[model samples]
Target: MADENGETRRQRNERFEFISPELQVPDGITHVWDWFWQLSGRRHSGPEALTFADVGEWSRLLGIEVLPEEVQMLMAMDDQYLRAVREDQRAARERAQQQ
Candidate 1:
């Protein structure tokens, strides 16, 4: 059902707020979230290596530090899950743009 804002609850729930580029490690965001956001942006930018090492290097380049446990969890997500997340984020972004 649509909310008062005319956006469906599902759409609101599916929305993934894009973190500002300036904040390398935004407050209240987990390491996995940061990693996923970077990965998603990279996937959009162009074809690139998708490896744990690459993630680590990216974090370093961004001046963000990710714990080992966080890296492990990020790497644990299989391709299917990652793709689903990317699609959902993209859809939410499109919806937001329309508003």
Candidate 2:
């Protein structure tokens, strides 16, 4: 249900979406914690994880200045954006190391 502020719970769920294998929240906190750790340790994720700058570049690359929040939802399956963000981070680290 949408609140008076116009934000829906489902919309927020979209933001946390990940490219994880099917997961079922089990009935116990211990098992849930284990599952949570496993999921966090997963090497795979979607492009929605793109950095803010990379997201801007993605908008330029896509010929659409879509808002960051919107892109965050749209790139739910975007591996390219994820790669771009990672590369950007690596470059920044290398530059820092050089200095």
Among these predictions, the greatest lDDT belongs to 1
| lDDT (Cα, 0-100) at 93 in candidate 1 | 86
- What are the Cα lDDT values of the candidates? 0.62, 0.47
lDDT of 2: 0.47
Candidate 1: give the clashing pairs.
none
Question: Candidate 1: deviation at residue 44, Å?
Answer: 7.2
What lDDT tens digits, residue by residue, belong to model 1 across residues 4-89? Answer: 46774456656745342353655665557656756756653332336877777788898978778777666664354556556756
Off-target runs (Cα >4 Å) in candidate 1 are 1-31, 44-49, 78-99
Winning candidate number (TM-score): 1
List candidate 2 stretches off by more than 4 Å: 1-77
TM-score attained by model 1: 0.42
Candidate 1 global Cα RMSD:
10.0
